[model samples]
Target: MKLTIVSRNPKSTKFPVTLELAGTASTIKTSDVNKALAAKFPKYYPDRQRLTTEDKKVLDLDKTLEEQGINEQSSIYFKDLGAQIGWRTVFMIEYAGPILIHPIFYYLSKFIYGSSFTHSPMQTVTYYMVMAHFFKRELETVFVHRFSHGTMPFRNVFKNSAHYWLLSGANLAFWVYGPWFAQGRAAAVRNDVWIYGSVAVWAWAELSNLITHITLRNLRPPGTRVRAIPYGYGFDLVSCPNYFFEFLAWTVVCFLTTSWSAFLFNIVATGQMYVWAVKKHKNYKKEFKDYPRNRTSMFPFIA
Candidate 1:
């Protein structure tokens, strides 16, 4: 069988390379084609580079080429994989981790270790808050965020899922149903002023985060690549106000639960958000000449 491999680069003058191979090779794989390409064009297909279809679909390297339906005189366009996965897939997996895992820890505590199904007011509120937070995140992943054209590394889904799922389980288990639950609730309500203040702050942060996300979504229409500076709401002060509100919301969770686990989760999450915010802020500045110079990355006037 003969197959033609074409490069996606429009400016390239190089002729398409043809490969002649035995059609009866039972174990022929995509990796074999990749190896052939690398061997044929050493400068283009270097050691670390990967090739994908023209539409950016990653080929199953281990699947047999025959099974993928490559036949004689077929043309396959190859482009760089560039160490990434689809952005929608990334967000879906990341949000799904917490959405699916949090409920297990929240409810499991009730059935295990002689714990009752009944929950205290504080416990109920914290449980609902955690559920609401992750639900909103899932909804935002579908409706409120615009992802640029690209992918993150395929491996990052595992790393991100582990981080979110583990933290969700830890925070909910320790704060809502574990031995620390009673003590944490006691500390939270020791002063009515503190309880009311923390609840108000949490609500405000959650709503503000949603608004910021909506504002960002509105900046770019669906199926368009144009990027404009986001205005109004929290965007006035910070380049990544959505992240700022997210950090604030988690911090408020720590206060509401008075749980060390919640505090630790907030700290770790905030650190990760901060890193992302900084990178995004720099990118905004680099991409737009009119980007607000006075805006910070995450913290207003501090970071």
Candidate 2:
């Protein structure tokens, strides 16, 4: 297999070199990269696992080289600045990150929502069967990690643990009872309330969630150095537009589900998020100082 390596530094230096190697996907790992870095630039080998640009363009090294679709004939590009970009390109799986709060939220949820039954609403009882399909898309996008085994935005996790806890927890719970739980067996989730009103409420909430995610993805992007979660948007001046919309989205989902199980899950889940967002909003006010004083904490009237 012939691999091409391109090195170009911000200083406008570019060197493209190709190497020949015979190996399978199993041989490629961040560790392998580190080893290559040690051999390639043993002196001042920086971490390549975090190949983030000054502007915050990051490449996930954990992705299976094959998964990255890098063929033997593939070409890898790098920036050369009269120096070895070891630290910037050498992929190392550093466990330096804080222990995530996923477990805490999970146990807390099990306690508050109670254990699910074979026929529990969380088991995907009878949610119009088809809506489950639509909700499936929402779950895949929002709480994707749990169901799809996909990666979350690296920045989102590093930015705010509290926010991460809320979003991750909510996504887990929703998937647990929905398609994932309801599959093979039967749909365990159902609502006897005003059918349209209830479903509409949930849909509206999900709609808002989608909207906020779209806004953030477009505005802040996932690869910014300011924060793992892309803060300092000074976008804070609007007083957590994301938070307000997020709250409404989850609250309306509770209304739609009408099932006490789902309602309780979203209420507690989103309520926790609301608190974090409000606190972050205040922090923004303090940090920016010039943060528009007219903006309300959450709602326009300031509840």
Candidate 3:
């Protein structure tokens, strides 16, 4: 089939080009059209192309061209989404900062608190906890996460990096090892149960979060953008169990640290995660007619 691509973006000048695509209109996907265009226009990658009908109606990449009413010799508008970065690269950069920044503060505590400064048991444990948590995130970014979107706007990297580096890295590290860290140690010693309980919950939440990631990964086949209703593990209770578990883990950290900064970070993170979870839940219901009726957005039984 032959198709014509007209540039809708004012920044692009290469369009009004006709290209031959290999499948019948029924067999060719929107993604296929994007690929065909990308092959001819080197600057327009598949991830950076947005296809629309003559009426400017968006075409879903997961659906076939026929489903979207596109046919032989059809003209579609191509909007170039500028300046993209791979999803994996974004996660790596953001997670890598916390791993290094946390430790730098941990060691600098010696100088910050003077030579007599020593780590309280909670500080020592949290130092290791912070390291392990971020290291696991880095490993998962490489081995576990399967992103539905291949790339994001390149400029978002700074905003994303600042969120992780400033909140989780610098702000968290300073509070955990700062002067206020030892103020409650004597009381904490008397209540070992809180420490042990929080640690246990944190560990369980971390493991469950990983399980949710694996479940999500298994939902899509390799090299495809297929989506399905997720079930099992924590998914049965909520549309986004991963976010639930992530919030739980951070809440545990806040409880263990008993620091005002830790609590503030937890609140900020939870608010952000809740917004994302609600959007994902809405999408799931919209995309799947039979999406589970009992499931909440991120909380079980209570949204």
Candidate 4:
């Protein structure tokens, strides 16, 4: 349907025309538009997700009401902006959840460090909980194709029913049961070095994790049009400085956490990333004969 567009910004002009929603809208009933506006500008309006027309007529923001011959009687209002992103596009192997989640990284980091200051087991524990929670979602999203289920599972998508169940199990384990594993091992001789060191490792590692994950993995970051090619691996860097840095960061976390829980977790998790990085590096060399000869997998330069 053609949407009427207007701008709160003076530089932009209003237009009226029907623009096809291409991976841009899951469903529009005027309610979705209001929800979009509210999410992006919560300060201006309340109950963002609940905004809709009384009679249920959807309004198009891409065109002006005049262009569409919109009558005042029409229930929907044409706002200055459309959804910065559509919910449909968010679910399409890209970034519906990340965009929503990115805003809280600072707070997460703060919480971790703040708890680390007190050396409180409770606060530090909560910090790692969020990481595994987010990481778990990323894992599920990355492997979503393996799963054949959605909110409503279609028969046509049943090919990966097994993968679906497996993903569901992972989701439960990581998000729900992930914390039980984050706790580090107990030691009879607890040194201040180990305690603070683990806290430092977890704090920085997660911070770096946020950065690399966002930069390398974020699909629809702001205005960028290019997708990540798993570049660190394709460069023939076997250790993948990214994964290495992550390990370095987490090693410290293990010290502070002082539990077999974290040790076992990193052993499995980082080990998988390491193996994948090596294979990816090798694949890069095989695929491109001219792969960089000087680069090592995890370490930089010095051949």
- Report lDDT (CA) for all predictions: 0.73, 0.44, 0.86, 0.42
Please report, as a residue range, the 10-residue window in candidate 4 with the lowest summed lDDT.
144-153
All candidates: CA RMSD in angstroms? 10.7, 15.3, 2.3, 16.2
> What would the C-alpha RMSD of candidate 3 be, to one decimal place?
2.3
lDDT of 1 by residue, 177-203 (tens): 564454434543445666667778888
What TM-score would you give candidate 1 relative to the actual structure? 0.69
Each model's total of backbone clashes? 0, 25, 0, 22
Name the lDDT value of residue 301 in candidate 3: 97
Q: Give the residue spans of candidate 2 off by over 4 A.
A: 1-193, 226-238, 256-258
* Model 4, global lDDT: 0.42
Give one digit per residue, the lDDT tens place, for model 2 in 1-303.
455555545453333445544566555643344345446555424342233322444434555456655666555555322232222111111111111333333334455446543334433322332244234434434433111112333343434443333343344344444333432444333445544464566566555545554545554334432312223332344455656655665455454434465455556656666687688667766777566666665554663
**Per-residue C-alpha lDDT of model 3 across residues 63-118, encoded as one tens digit per residue:** 89889888876789988788899999999999988898888878887676664466
**TM-score, every prediction:** 0.69, 0.37, 0.91, 0.36
**Which rank order by TM-score, best down to worst?**
3, 1, 2, 4
